[model samples]
Target: MFDLNNFNQESASLIQELQKHVGEITAIRRFFHQHPELSRQEFKTADKIAALLESWNIKVTRNIGGTGLVGVITKGLSSKMIGIRADMDALPIDEATHKDYASVNQGVMHACGHDGHMAMLLLAAKYLSLEATFDGSIVLIFQPDEEDDAGARRMIEDGLFDKFPVDCVFGMHNYPNAPIGQVMISHGPQMAGTIGLEITVTGLGCHAAHAYNGIDSILVAAHIVVGLQTIVARNLPAQDAGVITIASIHAGKANNVIPQSVEMIGTIRYFDPKTAAIMEEKVKSVAQGIAAAFGASADVRLKHGYIATVNHTEQADFCIKTAQKLLKPEAICLTKKPSMGAEDFAFMLAAKPGCYLFIGNGPGDGGCTLHNPAFDFNDANILVGGAFWTQLTLDYLA
Candidate 1:
């Protein structure tokens, strides 16, 4: 059995030490937030991360899978290895938060709290380097393109695991709904997989004055959009969760013109892989049938996005135990249901047995939901998150 008293004492001391660096962490997060970089184009972000990691005398690798992945490895006495990941990409949304640290980059923002993740992991690196708290090795992964492109998969494809074999991997995201300093975790199906779909309905364009002179692609798109809803409502099982949303529709630019074709783009989300496949098929069938009814034809394309973030039960339980030992029992909340959102960390989980959890960023008073313009990574959670990472590393490597 692990000694709770010793663990608590050590964790509390670490938390106190982390608090001292809160200002520095906040500064780092703000700098990244101000100069936000988009998906795969995180060149500046990657350079900054590399420079920091190397400053700690931690061995660092750059341009691993692409231009934006920084892999820092610490060799220790024990051979056991674990990996910790932090995404380094920002969203494409324009800054709406009118703070001094508001995004300096035009039409880009760190609305998802990735900047905080990076800072916390960097703090972990600094602490680990100073104390050598863990017996085994730790791989610090700062990945890029998590907002849209699958940088995790790219790293895996480029032999991330093969190069530095890790027995287990762990990831964390800052959740907005949960209260600050509270940690939430779950055993399985933490987040859903996503698919982005685009459908183009083609029809004969004719003068708007004539009634039946040509097929109406706009009407066909509208029917397709409505028909797409029945797929989740009728086909999917009641217990299984699935969603289909038509987010974008474009056809005619002018008031009176009946455009030649209408393009519709949407997203599909599901937890189960089988259900996801079924939903994709249903989407195509519905689009084709709706277009046929309108005397039109549709070309449907579905692009597979991120996979479901499913946590390994054993790893999750271990993480919960670790959290309980480190923080007050009330600080950890076990989630009752899985979130419908998708995470690129799913790719890392696919490669190894691991878990993904949430470190609370507190309620959004003025801060909006994730991806919202007013959202900012709460500075209050910095110490909480950094302490959690440090403790988890020690516990896992113990």
Candidate 2:
């Protein structure tokens, strides 16, 4: 239980007003959880978000970057502007949480807590519209395809800023398993950049019994897999952060026959562009060299992904100070480490200065980790997160 007496009179009043709407905001979060949509396929999700914003008399724009939308709340005469974003897509996992409001749609769920994120932002919008007084404009971003594709990048390519440019942007995600009301942030690299890797190894096929009859692609792939591990160990400097994981591999279906080809796919994560390039070079070199030694051929393809989410120094400091004023002393996590997980919000940060922070979503004791089938966003955080966003917005635009 947070004590309102710790805050200034005006801040305390705003929190009290936001508390009155907790039930409504929680309902909205559950509604989104029940009807989750996949990346780039959020038609109904977009419609619902737009309707809610329009009903509040906020200016709404739709179909930016394929299903992404924007809502603008303007007050006073100052042109200074701020942008706040929330991702709208869900994952491909089937719901197993068995909550009363569990997903009605098959094979899709809001496993990443995007439902909670949207609800918090909407709560901020409602309060800002009806109660708060501030200058300049606030842009509420409803982004799509954050789970599988980079919807943030898509929205930027669609000219999100050119149309509704803001001086700075801010984003937040719900962190599962931490203390329910705690807030976490990093002053520098907050999330890692990613590169998608695909490798195909080609060799001759033969009967399994006659092991020497032809070149074995599976044997070559096995060697390559072991070799890729060395990129992080032998190639990269230990001080730098990097990961190379081969999550999937495919080969011959028949046990009695040797496969002619093997395909492997995985991801590379890193904080520095130079480190990423070094890892890429090592992967291609090792794979090709090993395949040739085994009398086979290897082809490597790399797809560029979201950049590392680096927070601007001044903006991050401002957020830290703001969190201190709003949260309990123990609820602020200044020592939290950056995550290897990637985020498309990096694209927006690249376009303008901003900060990305996280709000804790309680413990993960019962299959409650993110992207898990049984995971559900902690409903109680609706009020906690709502207050943080509302306060941050009021302070930034003050």
Candidate 3:
């Protein structure tokens, strides 16, 4: 365990050691940033990562799920293991930051700091393999398609845990608009689950001048959209925090003709499974009911998305205490409330006892929010993130 009284002194030494390798860490991050790849298509990225792990003498397993890779470093047979995950996919956004290391694959950029995550985990693996200070093992998961195909679930379905079993697992993301190197974690639901909703209302088409001759799907869909909003505000309890967003509506191409059908697309965000269930049921009922009232029928399609990222209390405490010992007091933040965003790591946490936390990425540089074309992962975070992973592994395996 890290002693609060000696944390400052000990952390200083640990950070200094991590700083020595900053050059290599930043270089690796820049390489990934420049050669960004899309989900499940990270061929070159996986090659680079595998080559690096092999160079460090760590056991490497490839193709767990699409382009996913696993690096194992075992120190002794303690029967205790931990898994750390890093996403390895870029988004379909053009680079706008104009950084020297900006993505060269035009219209594809690592706009979500996944490049930074890869560098951090790789550096940690390098250090642990060299130091051999622990008695168990560390499993490094480099997953693909985090933004699209539910890569975490794919890896699990492909037998990730069966092959590389672990007592617990962990994951981290860079928090935008906060001081660089700062850490935030909490118990219970730290991020919401998402459900994508699409509803199509069908009706008879008619001439614009003779509107009463046919049923109006546009009107029915508009009613359904407005009715869906009531699920969170008027239907759900006041204490429950849920969000229903009608993000898109498509009706007719021509203003002169009444469209035969209208489509409504939106999302349902919730922390509690019961809340999500109720919202789904309500959306279907309201859409069908409204369409029936308007003399039309509705077809509802729901695409399930990431689930709520709930953290184990003990694991969350361990994360906080580890961060408090590894960094300055001001750098540790005990989050007050969960964010509305969703994460695929929620799937990994569902199978293991662990927590998914955030490391700060400093202030917004005009367009630093996640998934933005101008977003760039701060290089200053490398040392801090690498050191935190090292200390956590050491303490946990002690």
Candidate 4:
């Protein structure tokens, strides 16, 4: 075990050093916020990150998974390696905050705090490069397409682990609900697995005046949606949690003519793998049954998404203790509830023993929830986050 007192003393000095670059860090974050890019299409974003990493004398590898997902490696003394990841994707939301740094792209915004994640990781890379503080190699991953595509899995598929396998991997996301300067770590499941589903109900089109002449696909879709709720409310165990939400429904264009097909899109979230499988089975069964009852046929397509992020118990404890020593004891939260939001970092955890933690991005007073048009990454948490990352690297690699 590492000495907590010594770690705190070193971390405090490191954080103070990090504070000196707060202006540059904040500027980089805002530049990313203003010129946001979407999913697999982050060309300029990747270039900017690569340039910065190269300037720090860190080895940069580009086009690993796709146009995005830049990997930077800092060689150290120890043979053991650890990975730190930060996402670099923006959403398709138009800027609504009305700030001067609001996104210049009409419908692209970094509302999910990826900009801040990238900035903090970059700061950590610079510090580690200059100080050579950690003993083992550290891999800084700036992944893309986190909002839409599973960039983590893509990178893994493209030989991320085979090329640079690490003993442990760590990831972080900004949490708006938590107070600023705080860190939350949880054991076991930290985020629910997500499945994107599209259900198409086909029926014979007819005039609205003739009610009995044709099957109404809209009615079938409605029944299917309501019935799918039973999968969570009744089928799953009371202790387990799951959600089935239908976010979109497309059917008739005109009031007079019934449409031939009705398309519905939704997402399913569950923490347990068994529960997730059961929910998928139930959804398919409900869609088929409801379609048959309405004299229509249904086609349900399920797109496998990110797996649930389950933090290793020992790793979570280690992170909590390290965080407590670096920051105030009150600033460390250990019992945070798992969120339904999905993360691509789940892929990294699936391959290695690791943990994904939440760092406070401050309250949503004027700021908005993640994925919202008005959301912006908070600069106040830069030192706090940089300190945490630096301390975690030293503790794990020592």
Candidate 5:
């Protein structure tokens, strides 16, 4: 545990030292906000990041996993190393904030605070390069395509850990609607695993006036949608958590005719693998059974996505202690209830022992929540996030 009394003076000094780099970091964040790129297409984003890191006299490695890069900084004689990660992709949402630095690229925006993440990590890298007294190396990862695809998985498949391995890795994301200056850390599962579901119901097409002549696929599809709900309501235990949402449904084009097939698409979220497996089995069984009862046939497809993000206990405790040194005692929260949302960083945790953290992004009023067009990264978090990153590196590498 961090000694608050012994580290109070050091924390203050670190905050002051971090402040000197805030201006440039904030400007760089805004620049990224203006010139946003979609996943797997972050060519310009990669170029700019590489240029800035090179200018700071850090060794840069490029094209690890399509547009992903790593920056290295070494100090002292120890061989121990730590890895810190930041995502580098923007959503396909148009700019709605109307800020001066709003996205110049149409149909693209930094609605999920990836811009702020990059800036904070960049500041940490720069500060560590200049003032690091710790022994060993620091690996700064700038990953791309976190929105649609798992960039962390891609990086690992492309030999990321093999090329520049570390003892452990760490990642952080901004949490909107939380009080500013507060942080949340979970010891176990912090995010849910996601599964994509696509169901197709096939039946004989017939005129609406004489619907009795043939089976209606649309009607069967509706029943399947309703039946899927029971998987969570009746199948799972009372204490377990899971979600089944039907987001999109497509069937008939005209009111007078029944379509031959209906397509339904949605997502599934759960913290436990057993729960996920049960949901998957139930989804298929329910759809097939309902279709058979309606004289229709069904086909279900499940695309597995990122797994649940489970933080290692020791690393999570270390992170909490490090955060205690930087934040007030009341500002640190150790939560057991995890978010229903999914993160690709879960893949990284699966690869190595690590911890994922959340920093408050202030209020989410006026459509500022994540994935919303009006969302923007709060500039106020630069100092706190950067200082935390810097201090965590120093302590972990010491």
Candidate 6:
């Protein structure tokens, strides 16, 4: 076990104070969980965050882009600033955890642990506002619409970094599989870029009894799905990790007739832009080619969502070192493989040099995995996250 007594005095004291407030932090997390909101519509969440920040005398900004907000905490004239983001929106999955604080909103839940994320950042915000001993500034961002990948972009368009002028920014997410309290850090390609594709296969429709007279869109869609399965395997090289997932296909509704058109929708995940572009091109070409061979037409629409969350080397290393100062070295998982999932945090990293790291939710049982109907944010992990943020802020500002 790592000993906190070996750490610097400030670090130990901050961790001690943080651990003392576990119940309060967990209560705040449960409150957010009970009143969940969807992306770009976090009105109540934004208000609550603003109120909490205001209570601590952290300057609050409301409604920058949609329902997103920022809480600024400054101590001195130092130009250095740190940006810590916590997503406030919930997923569309229904709650299944059956906890006392399970989501009250129908068909919406904090399955991604945004509630814990908010609680951690809010804890840091409140603490720093009350007891910060740093010379620089910190911006606690309660971002919205992370599920939709529009929150970060919207916040940028609303002049977030421009308005605050931060030297670097950082973001945190909770991973369900890692042992709770473990921190995962990676420098490059921390997460994959995501592209959503919708391909509509069009063909002539006719009576099922006379199927030979008209083209079959359902058959064409099946071919497209099968053909798409090859782009990741055939087009991309072995070292280049990419995925082409065809999630949904909609076609005929009746048993007696062939459908006129079928829609195939899915996502493409990649780390490199060239590979993503190549995969997208192959998707359109193969889709159209197969559809045309079946006497059908394919209309493909590919919408680029979140970009790969690439981390800057210096910032990532700084984060790891900062985290190590507070916890045991083994508590930080530096070799954890980058996830193929995408994040809007990529946008902020694109504009600023920073790191986006993960806190472990731990796996195996109830409410651990993200976006699952049964997932709940682990309350115990809040101390780890809060301590890391608070110490990292004090260190960065120092």
TM-score of each: 0.92, 0.96, 0.96, 0.92, 0.96, 0.94
Q: C-alpha displacement of 347 in model 3, angstroms?
A: 0.8
- What are the per-residue Cα lDDT tens digits for candidate 4 across 188-228? 99888999999999988999889689998888888998998
lDDT of 5 by residue, 1-398 (tens): 12223235658888778778889999999999999999999999999999999998899999999999999999889888899999999999988998999999999999999999999899898899887678999999999999989999999999999998888999999998876646688788999999999999999999999999989999999899999999999999988889988899998889899989999999999989999999999999999999999999999999999899999999999999898877776667786368999999999999889999988788898899999999999887777778888989999988
Which model, 1 or 2, shows the larger TM-score? 2
Among residues 3 or more apart in sequence or in different chains, the pairs in candidate 2 whose N, CA or C atoms overlap within 3 Å are: none
Off by over 4 Å in 4: 1-10, 69-76
Model 6 residue runs over 4 Å out of place are 1-10
**If both were scored by lDDT, which would come out higher, candidate 1 or candidate 6?**
6
Off by over 4 Å in 1: 1-10, 71-75
- Provide the global lDDT of candidate 6 against the true structure: 0.87
Residue 369 Cα positional deviation in candidate 3, in Å, after optimal superposition: 1.2
The digit string of per-residue lDDT tens for model 2 on 122-169 reads: 998888887789998999999999987899999999999999989999
Candidate 3 residue-wise lDDT, 253-285, digit = tens: 887899999888889899999999899898899
Worst 10 residues of 1 by lDDT: 1-10
Question: In model 4, what lDDT does residue 233 have?
Answer: 90
Clashing pairs in 3: none
Report the Cα lDDT for residue 387, model 2: 81
CA lDDT for candidate 5: 0.90
lDDT of every model, 2 decimals: 0.84, 0.90, 0.88, 0.84, 0.90, 0.87
